[model samples]
Each structure stands twice: as structure tokens, then as C-alpha cells.
Target: MTPKLVAGIEPPYYTAVFTSVRPDAPEGYAETSVRMQEIVREVPGFLGYESARTPGGIGITVAYFRDLEALDKWRLDTEHQAAKRYGREHWYDSYSVHIGKVERSYGFERE
Candidate 1:
């Protein structure tokens, strides 16, 4: 399947980059991941997201938000909080999150 690339995003936005490694037995991870994706779209400041995973169990998800306040809202979402707990307890072997402000972005696509 072709991964969809986020487009039309301007600078001065915020991004939450989540990098993780899955445990050997990742029970419920896929479902929770899908749920989180759905929930994020409902967030007020949500812009878009890009995600990829390697066969070696390493995954990275970059979520875009309109601003810091919007990013904070997602950070404090109840369902998302629960998913984080579940990931810590059951799904992930390890993970890291980095928040950044995008000053500029550029890309190209061949038509």
C-alpha cells in the first residue's frame, strides 16, 4: 500500500514526533494505534500526520498541529492518555517523543 503524504501544511506549526519499538508480543497495539489516529483527527488543532514502520519493529509517527495549544490539547486527551499507559504496560518495548516547531518545509511530487 502507498502511504499518503501530508500536503498544504505551512510553517509555524507544531509537530509531535513519536518513535517506538514494538515488543515481541504486541497484543492490541494495532487496534489502539488506529483508534488514536481517528481520535487525533477530532482534535481541534490537528493538521495531519505521517507514519511509517520498519519490519524490525521500529516505527515513527509525526503528528502536526496548528499551534502549541493545539498540541497541548492532544497531549492531555483522556483516551490518548490511556493509550499511552497501555503502550507502556503492554505494547511497546520502548518509545520516545519529541515536539518541535516547524519554521519551514519543502517537498516535491512528480505528476
Candidate 2:
């Protein structure tokens, strides 16, 4: 079974969406990714995160934060900086990051 990569977050929050193409050789990608996940949880204002990937090597990760300040801090984290460097050097072929404020959101779930 596949996991759900969508987080349940409240409004008046910030979202960081990262879209990227997989690297040809992901040597330490998995380990680094797990480490980053753990690190983010410890950061203040971190709400949640979700991720998904396609068979074609394209992927997206969405992380929620209480505000832009928290998001900016996460972006400058030392460990995350290392990961970004690694990604540019060996992991990602291409990528883009977009941060936005979610003013209103609505959804439906049926049992």
C-alpha cells in the first residue's frame, strides 16, 4: 500500500512546495531525506509535511509552517543547506521552490 502524502493543516498558514527531478545517482539521498524530516519536526512552528513521487522521477514535497519566519529559518538550516548542496551536486537534475500563504482552504471527507 502507498502512503498518503497530503497533510491536514489549518488555514492562515504557510506552505512550501518543492518540485524536483530525481538524480541519476541518489547515493545518500534517502538518508539525508530522513534526517531532514527528523530535523524539521524539531524546528519551531513546523506543522507537518507530505511528499509524493512519480515513476518518471518527478516528485513534490509540501511542508507546512506557522508562518514565513519559520519557513525562512528552515530554509537556512545548516543541515538543510548541506542537503541542498548535495542535491545540486548529485541529486537533482532540476527543481523549484514556491512558498505561499494559504488564506482559505476547504475540503470534504466521507466515511
Candidate 3:
């Protein structure tokens, strides 16, 4: 499968990088993840996101936002909070979230 790469975004945005180690038995994880992705799109300052998971159960999702305020809204979203709780209880064995500002970014694509 082709990896999805977020492109054309200007600099000075914020990114929330979520990395996780999933448990062998991931019951509701996939559904919740899809729902969260849908929900984030409705947020005011949402830019775009890129995500991928390895066969070994390690996953990373990077969500982009226009600025810090938009990132905060996502952090405090009610449904997202619930999803986080559920993931902690049932889905993720371990996880980490890194939020940072992208002062500059560049990329190249082949035709």
C-alpha cells in the first residue's frame, strides 16, 4: 500500500505526533481510530494528517494544525479524551505524544 503523505502545508504549523505500541488483542482500536480521524477534520484549524502502522503493531499518526490554539482544541476535545481513555484501558500497551511547531518544512516527490 502507498503511504499517505501530507503535502503543500506551509511552515509555522503545529504537529501532534502520536506513537503507540498496540496490544495483540486490539478490539475496538481500529474503529475508534477511524472515528477520531473523522472528528479531527471538523476542527477549526485542522490542516491534515498522515498515519501508518507496522506489522509489528507499532503505529504513528501525525496530525497538523494551523497553530497552537487549534492544537489545544484538539487536546481538549471531549470525544478525543474519551478515545484516549479507551485506548489506555484496552488498546494501547504503551504510547507517547509529542507536540511541536514546524518552523520550516520541505519535501520532494517523484512522478
User: Which candidate leads the pack in lDDT?
Assistant: 3
Model 1, stretches more than 4 Å misplaced? Answer: none
**lDDT tens digits by residue: candidate 3, 3-98:** 658988999999999999996548877788789989899899999998878989898989999999999998999999999998888788899999
**Candidate order by decreasing lDDT:** 3, 1, 2
Per-model lDDT: 0.89, 0.87, 0.89
Residue pairs whose backbone atoms clash in candidate 3: none
State the displacement of the C-alpha of residue 53, model 1, in Å, after optimal TM-score superposition.
0.6
What are the root-mean-square deviations of the candidates from the true structure over C-alphas?
1.4, 1.8, 1.4
Give one digit per residue, the lDDT tens place, for model 2 in 1-111.
555544456789999999999854378888888899999998899998888788889999999999988998899999999889978998888999999999987765554
Residue pairs with backbone overlap in model 1: none
Please give me the total number of clashing residue pairs in predicted model 1: 0
Query: What are the per-model numbers of colliding residue pairs?
Result: 0, 0, 0
TM-score: model 1 vs. ground truth: 0.93
Model 1 poorest ten-residue lDDT run: 23-32
For 39-104, candidate 1 gives per-residue lDDT tens digits of 989989899999878988899999999999989989999999999997888788899999999999
